[model samples]
Target: MEVTQANILETLPQDMIVEILSRVGQNSSDQLLILKSVCKSFLKLSEDPLVLKRLSLDRWRLSPWGNPKLIYLFNLCTVFGNPNAIFCLGLIGYFDTKYTDLGLDFLKRASNSQLKEAVYVYGVIIFASHQIEAKHVGLQILNETFPPVPELVVAVRIKVFDLMRQLWLFNRHPFDDVAMPCPISDHDGYFPQFHGFEIAIPECMSCFWAYELDVFANRFAYN
Candidate 1:
């Protein structure tokens, strides 16, 4: 009976293999982090930017309750050299808390991989986030960041934009948008508010259509 290494690998149980991968991800070396962090020429944020990165992080979302032991388990993909699992989860919109920035971080790390879907979704998030930012920092920069929401996500983005505008009008600062939370429900979902300054504008429809056109024009916009 001539056994080969291939046979041994094949014979290993799937769960066992997964466990091994999980361990590797948890114990990822400092060198690997540096190698990944520097992959993109300008991805690394300045030290101050790194502080901004952690400013609003919800640690519980990463590893809930008191069990921080699985923290690396969530980061296993990084250690195992596959960011797709993390990317796929982001697309499904599960990272509601810190999902947007977290996705971007993983993205900057895996810039070499074909991540069209992830990129598109990231655009959606960046648009919303930057829209909120525009309220305070100045519409010009936010305009550049959020721009037009992708067509498919247009309807939602318009609502986001309107709320953002309201936030800006009322709160009056970029960081204030984040500091203040809007009790936003779908204005378009029910009877339209035809009165008041917050009334839905036809321009929002423009934003929506822009997104649709963008999706169709580019064979791949942000699906």
Candidate 2:
């Protein structure tokens, strides 16, 4: 009967309530949990597919061996097509378990969602497969992040490098044995001449991107 925040929220339309909840916990699952505990209405609406899809598990460490409750939460998010959840599950499945195909499928899904990190890693993985058609598709995927301009390419490289670093910090093993797209033999005779010195530039765009992937993969590779 008294005016309260819960009362006000309850009076709002369901779409409005869902929109508000979607923004409530964009970065922290803990916030969502607390939100769900606030009221019965909140609890029921918190699991709405729209809310779940936008929820971020950023504050949570992703691990198959992690807390079962958290894992369940991740599963819920994944079911609703949360890109980050799909990426996390893909990494765990691809690296920690024997379900590599399933993991790749999830990664592809995440990539299709335009999650930049997913796009970068999935492209690199596919490129490293060494099959000609896969390499072409992979290169096309990688090219989506990198524009033709040199400056833009550098910017994407740095952004992707930072993303890879964050992933390595949380999920190291999966990145450990990633195959390099460019072999050592291909590296020779590809360097361009610059200021009377040999530069690391490759002869082709494909190799150049391959070099970028190799550098990133090696930079994060476990010792």
Candidate 3:
């Protein structure tokens, strides 16, 4: 195409551009990266975390595209090292309704020796970030799948304790609300039944909270 033709194509509607990019993204090829770097609009779409995240994982049962999407996701987890990688791993189930069981499976698989520590820290972060939300989706996978993951859970709790101490000395009072970095700042703000203790990941769950735990069970077991 001539330079003028190329310039005209570049003026396509933003919506059309995004639509084309998403369609091309479905191809599972690195060529998408090249196109992204060629223009501002394409770069923005490509950088969307969800886009890269989905590209990094297997397409929901959309078999044989690249023939190694699972390995690709695992390799990505190893390379860039994002805790959310596991979450994205779990997100695949959302694409194909039939695979929702992978939610629980994702967490359970995370208990693999390699994934345990990440699970623990992330679990506490998720749980304590906000008890209401935390209680709904904490490390139920680690607890339910391993059922006896007290040591791992407790370790994460202790790490948070240490982190809190660090915050007190630096951020000065350390009681800032956050996923992590709140010092001595603990609250089961949502689940009082844990002995009136707001244990995030939990060394153990009391009988009273069993029903509350069901939230993750169904979501984990299904979505």
Q: Pick the candidate with the highest lDDT.
A: 2
Task: List candidate 3 segments past 4 Å from native.
Answer: 1-6, 48-223
Error of 1 at 81 (Å): 3.3
Q: Write the per-residue lDDT of candidate 3 for residues 193-215, one digit (tens) a residue.
A: 24344434533353213322232
Model 1 over residues 95-146: C-alpha lDDT tens digits?
Answer: 3333445645664343234343333334433333435453222223223334
Off by over 4 Å in 1: 1-75, 88-94, 98-100, 107-112, 128-209, 212-223
Please report how far candidate 2 places residue 166 from its true position, in Å.
11
Give the worst 10-residue stretch by lDDT in candidate 3: 166-175
Between the candidate structures 1 and 2, which one is better when assessed by TM-score?
A: 2
Clashing pairs in 2: none
Q: Mind giving the per-residue lDDT tens digits that candidate 2 earns over 129-218?
A: 656787778888977865544444555456545434434344344446555445435554223345453344445667676666566567
TM-score to native of every candidate shown: 0.27, 0.71, 0.27
Reference-based lDDT, residue 87, model 2: 83
Please report, in order, the local distance difference test score of every candidate based on alpha carbons. 0.35, 0.70, 0.43
Q: What TM-score does prediction 2 earn? A: 0.71
